[model samples]
Target: MPVRHFDFFTAERRLVHTNPISLLKDTRLGIEGNHWLRKLLQNHVKEPAVVAMGGIPLGLRAAIERELDLLK
Candidate 1:
């Protein structure tokens, strides 16, 4: 359920898949939660910051952990 959006484009075409934060935005943990979550798996993000996100997305947590070696 926790899937991020991805966009791939070429000279003549574009492809997009989006799964931006859903229910979280509807809760008390809205935009602020989204900002950090957006940064979670990025190459520049480090462990401490990742930890501060409070938690990871339901389905993607495992993959995120694997991608972020420190979390593994």
Candidate 2:
């Protein structure tokens, strides 16, 4: 079995990333939540754009679903 583990780190201050690709490449790409990966991606996205793309929250939801689909 692939033994999975999780841990969390809180920067003294919140960190923001304008470029997610670079952020992902950064070694600190770790999170505590089971959906941390998805949450991180959602956080980097500007909320206004999310609302503009569609009044619904489907964009991130779709992205998250797509990611999970690929994992399976």
Candidate 3:
């Protein structure tokens, strides 16, 4: 699949709830109007699934998106 840039403004802010065995559990990384932040997490985290909403950034999102494959 082609890696498409996420629209921060259009995107929804949320959290990613993980299991006790999961290090990502309670690790908040969701936000709106901040594509960079979402991208950053999308790249780094194994499964960048939103669990809750919060403040997000652009640089961070970009970083995450860059490492998205690595997360997989």
Indicate the residue-level lDDT of 70 in model 2. Answer: 47
Candidate 3 lDDT over 1-72, as tens digits, reads 423543432355533344554565567654343554444466654433334444453355556555554434
Better TM-score candidate (1, 2): 2
Q: Per-residue alpha-carbon lDDT of model 2 for 1-72, expressed as tens digits?
A: 322431222233435335635444436544344456545465743466654676545455666677556434
Q: Candidate 1: where is the Cα deviation over 4 Å?
A: 1-31, 44-59, 63-72
Predictions: Cα RMSD each: 13.2, 10.0, 14.5
- TM-score, structure 3 vs. true: 0.20
Better of 1 and 3 by lDDT: 3
What is the C-alpha lDDT profile of model 1 across 1-72, one tens digit per residue? 333442222222654334554523545632234544566645434456546677754445664556445422
lDDT of each: 0.46, 0.50, 0.47
Per-model TM against the reference? 0.20, 0.29, 0.20
The number of clashing residue pairs in model 2 is 0
Model 2 regions lying over 4 Å from their true place = 1-31, 34-39, 42-56
